[model samples]
Target chain A: MSEQDWRAIRAEAIESLLVERGLLDPADVDRVIETYNDRVGPMNGARMVARAWCDPDFKARLLADGTAAMAEFDFGGAQTEKLVVVENTPDTHNVVVCTLCSCYPWAVLGLPPRWYKDPAYRSRIVREPRRVLAEFGLVLDDDVRVRVWDSSAEVRYLVLPRRPADADGLDEAALAQRVTRDAMIGVAQP
Target chain B: MDGIHDLGGRAGFGPVEREADEPAFHERWEARVFAMIGAAAAAGAYRNADQFRHAIERIRPDAYLCDGYYGRWLAGLETLLREAGIVQADELRARIAALGGDPTRPGGARPAEAPDRVAYPPAGEGNRRSVAAAPVFAEGDRVRTASFGVSGHTRLPAYARGRRGTVTTWHGAWVFPDSNAHGRGEQPQHLYTVVFDGVDLWGAAAEPGTAVSLDLFEPYLTAWTAEVDT
Candidate 1:
């Protein structure tokens, strides 16, 4: 069967299970699912970046205590306990991956992009970070050492992307324009 | 199944695929829970956000129980409502059917909210004690990967441990919660990295031009010099 056909079948099966078990009303599940697809994603991280750009003290706090620092902005949830924030500096670059599974900082960063959870990206990036970054349209100089973080159980990370050069004088929204999800993941720089 | 970080060097995978509009189920639940708690607090159901926050805060530290705690609360609410005849199983099913397809719709029996709050205790709090900064080495300093016995979850991959390399960066002192998280919280050590030549990792058979780096935690290393001690 086609992928769409399979999805339809899966949805039907899930609906049947929900009804039989009476775990949740299907309509409620639908609504919850919609909100998730619409509002969540790297946009969450982009907001964090914009806040960091505008506030130095908060940024310092973010680097020092990532979970607490993020709490000031009201960004925390279940699965956020293992949070560890990594920053990018002039000489060092930070990229995050879960080679085993898609363990991510869901609370602050929202849900991860599909590419992040892909097996292809997970398996190859750690061993060949430079090559993978090149494919993502990022080409770093040999002198700028590349450090790939293998985020596993107990600790998950979010990359504090270096601010973009062209974003000077831009307000939060405008600065947010430059903070792409790729930049946060260290695949690309803003 | 292998733990999530074990995917490196595996074969038969295609190039990465990016999904434009997809969110995991747990994340959706988290957001919905947050909103529900926020709205409830706003409605004065709880004395203050702190009260609600305190309730959750008490349970957040139990890593294993975190996920199931919310699930149980939701289940308990539904059960009470059902037992009191406020809502029937068939009625809930019918409402679901009436809503039709499109799971992304807004408003329904399902809650749409984020958690009340998520907190990570301050560094070196509770069971996590701060480690005194070890002056092992500095960036730009060349060092060799010390040969050490391996057990537990280590940042040092088997392929690169016990290899020689240069110190490219210092990651600062961490709680080393790997031991704690794994129920082996005896000694939480600091972690670091030393970038090895690709030749050192893959041996002489490796391509001469390539280079590799390994982030070695403090416990995995010892002092090294260029000259042989013998």
Candidate 2:
């Protein structure tokens, strides 16, 4: 059998072991998977970002204390208990990474992307963020101060990418459509 | 510990690659492993979240790299199961054989659980803790990260060691991973957002007009006196 096949069998064996011991129920596992896969993800973050773009007061609260501001939308949970939102101004561009582990803001952004968890990105982004971001097709100007936030502790970071110049007339929902996961991660512009 | 899992500032891993249309999970096994980890934690199989993280860090360097994210997670879960005395090697082999795999494959014996470790908090209880003592350093204070040689789990990355930075924001107190990873109680400490100049971290190789910010706990920092720079 292929390595993949063996892995599947190994996983099944462990699951059965845990179930037999009353430590786990297959139904509970399914519920956990569905929660992250469907109920949580980038859309939650996009809605918050869209509201910030449209409303000045919400944006002020979000930048001041992301964890408290998220309560207004009833949107904070696991992996984001203490949320911190960094804004990207014309002179400053912000990015987020976790050098120790893939400590992502899961409540808002869902599971981290493959690249976000990859060793190359983890190792190099803090040392050379401009080059790393450039490789992701985001070439920042030399004058823009790049701020790389490494979430080493419990506090998780979410980058509020600068709203595009052309998105002036868009409504909150329309503005939300432009906020992609990569943009919130500070690798792309919405 | 300065293990292979601490990848910050190390080079030669190559460029970051993104999938064309990356799914939330690459495969069914990945999803199963993810859920299994949650189930294990909920079952009180782990002392704390830090202990689970240290399990993955304890992986043999070569083997750790061989597997992807979920794969490393699987290895960690197996390690936890064995260490907790919940699963034995013979049982694993027998189950594998029953499921039609080669039982002759080498497997190590189960390890005895550490008797001195602290118990994990109930499933939903987070790491946040409230303390009456005020934070040592306030926002806008110049501080220097403490340089220590610890052979245990620490959130302080090697790249940021011994660097001088400013406390940009105070995040209140949080569970210190170094103590918690060893089955120690949650010795929560004041945490802050320290922003360091890129040049201070990377020296000549740093990009101009760039800064690296880290959420650091109080024990990792001290006041950066002006005399220290001179």
Alpha-carbon lDDT, every model: 0.54, 0.84
TM-score of each: 0.57, 0.94
What are the candidates' interface root-mean-square deviations? 8.8, 1.4
Candidate 1 runs further than 4 Å off? A7-11, B1-5, B11-14, B19-230
The DockQ for candidate 2, computed on C-alphas, is: 0.73
Error of 1 at A49 (Å): 1.2
Residue B7 in candidate 2, Cα distance off native in Å: 0.8
Model 1 per-residue lDDT tens digits across residues A1-190? 3423322332343344434655445466556556446565567778888888888987888777787876776776644664556788877777777664455777666656656765578777766777778788787777666667665333557788888777789998878777877787778888
Candidate 2 local lDDT, B25-87, one digit each (tens)? 777878888888888877666867788888888777776666778777887888788777787
Candidate 2, residues A1-190: lDDT per residue as tens digits?
7767666777777888998998887886667668777888898899999999999999999999998887887886778878899899999999999988899999889989988988999999998999999999999999999999998988888999888899989999999999999999999998
Model 1 Cα shift for residue B41 (angstroms): 25
Error in Å for residue A117 of model 1: 1.6
